[model samples]
Target chain A: MYEFFHDPIYFLTMIGTVVFALSGAMAAARKELDIFGFIIVGLAPAVGGGTVRDLLLNAEKVFWIEDLNFLYVVIVVAVIAFFQVHRLEGKRYTLLMWADAFGLALFTIMGTQIAMTYDIHPVMVVVMGMITGTFGGMVRDIICNEVPFLLQKEIYALAAIVGSCAYLFFLHLGLDEQGAMVISVAATFIVRGLAIVFGWSLPPYKAGGSPT
Target chain B: MYEFFHDPIYFLTMIGTVVFALSGAMAAARKELDIFGFIIVGLAPAVGGGTVRDLLLNAEKVFWIEDLNFLYVVIVVAVIAFFQVHRLEGKRYTLLMWADAFGLALFTIMGTQIAMTYDIHPVMVVVMGMITGTFGGMVRDIICNEVPFLLQKEIYALAAIVGSCAYLFFLHLGLDEQGAMVISVAATFIVRGLAIVFGWSLPPYKAGGSPT
Candidate 1:
């Protein structure tokens, strides 16, 4: 169980980190930020979740503090994105959107796995998953001085919740860790992708203009 | 011990919530947001810390959910600020800045206490304090399309850290809870206010251009 859980978690986290970093860099490019801004955005989205998680869990050190590779990955991605901005112009948004969705899904599953390792309850694990998946981007948006996507646009966080629920259900059904992760990530991606494609949104509250 | 902790915690939290709500509404008034935006900003800063804590702790329900008074306080403050914006403009920035500093101090101490209640380590508690104190303002700034003071300014988060350290040290000295709380909040406020007054700041990293 340890071997199965550990290796897959590491791989998924690496992939999610890279994808988030690239998407963050893409956002910085669109915002016309300089090299330093791009690097900060990229690094925040890549490592912000783990930083939050480690803090909450009272883990020994932050993920990036423990491993410089995460920082290097974000730096490399930001640099690449910065130089290739023109090539990415037309497809930038779409590419970043998809990458963000993928990262979200992967991080959600990975977060749940880590929470379980700590013996936290399933419901708590689900919440952690949502935090891990969405918070980095939320932080990124805040840093960029934009309304976080979670607050305004598509059902991004709701998708993470749905995936967490699916993961819990699969675990209840006695699926192996690998199988449950696959199902969870796939569910998150599907929900998020569909929302993006369909422009789905939660109903906005229609508060009257001014109440006398 | 439980009884000793209960009432003081509740009182401190109430004070923190009210001040943060007022500060947030004051910020919104400066930005000329309508009633709705004002209310949202007020509520976000007031309830944001407890909400984040509960989510991370996997508590049964968010603190605001358990006590609707938190929402009521924010709404009332927002409403008052909206109507009183004209008068507030006389000392708008000054009032808001002081209120923000007070809110930061109060919330940071409260958050650290809560984390300690959950048996988290001191380091993690300090981190949580910093998050609780500053993240709300970060959210408010983002919604207002401004750079977060934490990233732009040097001493903002550092003040919270100093207060957290002070709180821990007092606790180590076996001071009563109220003593620790007062000392911590006073320490944070003093540091932040001095920074504002004296233009004390950590040296900015040597960089060619503005980060933004």
Candidate 2:
């Protein structure tokens, strides 16, 4: 337990959790939800992805349930953000986007790493990584009643896929796990970061003369 | 495996899966999502609740993953509905509502039953039941970019809670499990059905001169 706290990965995971919580809170603010709504929405992104990943992998126990620290962090951050988010007004959207990107990057690497430990097919590893990185935000958007930016917008899941593949490639080349994780996270973050700044997005499907 | 299929509960579970799949596909049609989107969205409600319950309970495998039949059923139903939904244009809304109610009741009872096997508190069991019944529709609404009808309108989750409690109450009174499930399902379906038919809903929160 003592050694667990010292792990650098755990530090990054906490940061991811905090940012995701903030992202969810900002979304709740947009919806004009009550305080209870803020916490529920906030907790969605903070824990949603990892919970899904763990369930898919059939992990013995969910991480947050095993360690109350993550749950506490989400609740505390969300409550604080509820009081502070309104102050950001003009800048809240930008902050939320950046926070989501960072959360995505951190979660993508962590998920890919965990999946690798399970000895599943490499394709499944990348798929798990993407699910972990993207699912929480999707749930948040759904709860907020918006089309998930992940599905309709710029290369979001693609970025996670790229990072997962990059990590695998690096590991196959004998790169140390930590070094590969750092590089892969950078890969995902930079890709998503550039998409945000440049307004990059995939073209909408225009086939069949528009949907009903 | 043969005995598992022979169980009466499994039959209801299959009906629940089919209706949930149909419900999700109908939602996707409203969004005008393509076939791929139909499959993805349809799968959300069909398996989402059970998957979450299993994860929370630390079940050895998620129910759908353990049995591919559920996944296949969802996919086939979604594909069929993608084509058939437009035919029900005038009646689609009414059908969707009924489908959702049935799905809710079936999932609620199943979730409550599973939680009871875990020996948790009665409150947690009901909470799990509500989560199982409601989380899927919430996800469906979220994916469809609608504020969760569950959170905003009607006594959806409340119905699930009522059913869960009814099941618990019956069991405590020494009723058999199968009988308890049948009665509870009726309780939930009737409550939600009345809400739908009569347009019943919870009053909105209006504290502090409205939000935002």
Candidate 3:
């Protein structure tokens, strides 16, 4: 077995990259951006989270920089999606949400696992996971000048946090790495999916009784 | 002089941190965010850019995490500005703009100086400098759900890039580290200040005549 369970994790990371890139491309299309705009925005979420995770952990090298495949996949996916997104008609938002859900799930587990190598506090690990999962989309929203999905009442970062905790819990229960990852991804995906279909959200923060 | 010319750079970095935090806090005040919101938003612009730069370069330790002073300064400034911003009254926007200009100038030079140690291509060094100068405000604007000042029709990132190039140019011309830094900061501040006062901006990117 590889130390980081290299094969499966790497495969899922690529999938997450592709999905997030597609979401970004679709966002660009919605905003009526030019081709260069599509590529820039698409690339942001695709690599943003992982780049941040690697930075915070001081990884030996940033992952995409070390492996060109992630970059190629995102570029190809973005270009393809930029043209194809218009055909989705009204289904674009739905597709983007689902794509983001999977990206969130995969990245949350990947980030948690990477941070695990550093032997930091468990809370920090979870926060890293959430950062990895949410930052990409938050950046995408920022570029498009929309309120970030994470900062809104959406049940987004909470899902990543819960999934990160589940991964730790499963690992403690003696599950193998692959099993823990699988369960963790499913847990995050389900929570986020439910929120999308049902509109579940945290209450908006209301400032208390007029500041002194 | 110290290897990185530690004393002057360190003092300027702190000054940059305080100014950026004040800008963020003022933004929160404009948005009427709660005290917690003020701190969180304020902290983002204060540390966000350097954090991104450190991560990209794989710094041994993130600066703030290694030195608590930067973090403490941001928090204190954020809290103080949360209450004091209201008193700035009609001057708040002007104050925020000027503070941001100083932060941009300081951070651009600081980031360029740090990246110089890595021996990367000069272009990458300049890019890093721009990222360091602009990302904080971009993030603050993102959190507040406004179009990022960097992304819009503003002379923001251009100023950082110009300063980064000037730093490189001066150093290449055999100027000492301190001289290079001083000139670079002044160049950036003048360019950005002119934009703020005279409304200079890059024209909006227009998609070519209805894509085929």
lDDT of 3: 0.82
Better of 1 and 2 by DockQ: 2
Q: Which candidate is the best by TM-score?
A: 3
Q: Model 2 off-target regions past 4 Å?
A: A1-6, A202-212, B1-51, B55-130, B136-145, B153-212
- Report the Cα lDDT for residue A38, model 1: 90
Residue-level lDDT tens digits of model 1 in B1-212: 22224776667667777788887776665555556556667877787766676667665555554355676778787787666656655677777677778888988887787678777777888988888888877766666667767798548999999998899999899998789989999999999999888888887766897644
Which sections of candidate 3 miss by over 4 Å?
Answer: A1-42, A49-58, A64-139, A142-212, B1-5, B206-212
Chain A TM-scores, per candidate, are 0.91, 0.93, 0.92
Q: How many clashing residue pairs appear in each of the predictions shown?
A: 0, 1, 0
lDDT of 3 by residue, A1-212 (tens): 11544776778888898999988887776666655456567878998887778777767777665456766787788667655666776776787799889999999988898888887999999999999899988878878888777898889999999999999999999999889999999999999999999999887757985433
Q: Give DockQ: model 3.
A: 0.15
- Prediction 2 global C-alpha lDDT: 0.82
Q: Is the docking of candidate 1 incorrect, acceptable, medium or high quality?
A: incorrect
Residue B184, model 3: lDDT of 94
Going through the candidates in order, their DockQ values are: 0.11, 0.16, 0.15
Kindly indicate the candidate among 1 and 3 with the higher DockQ.
3
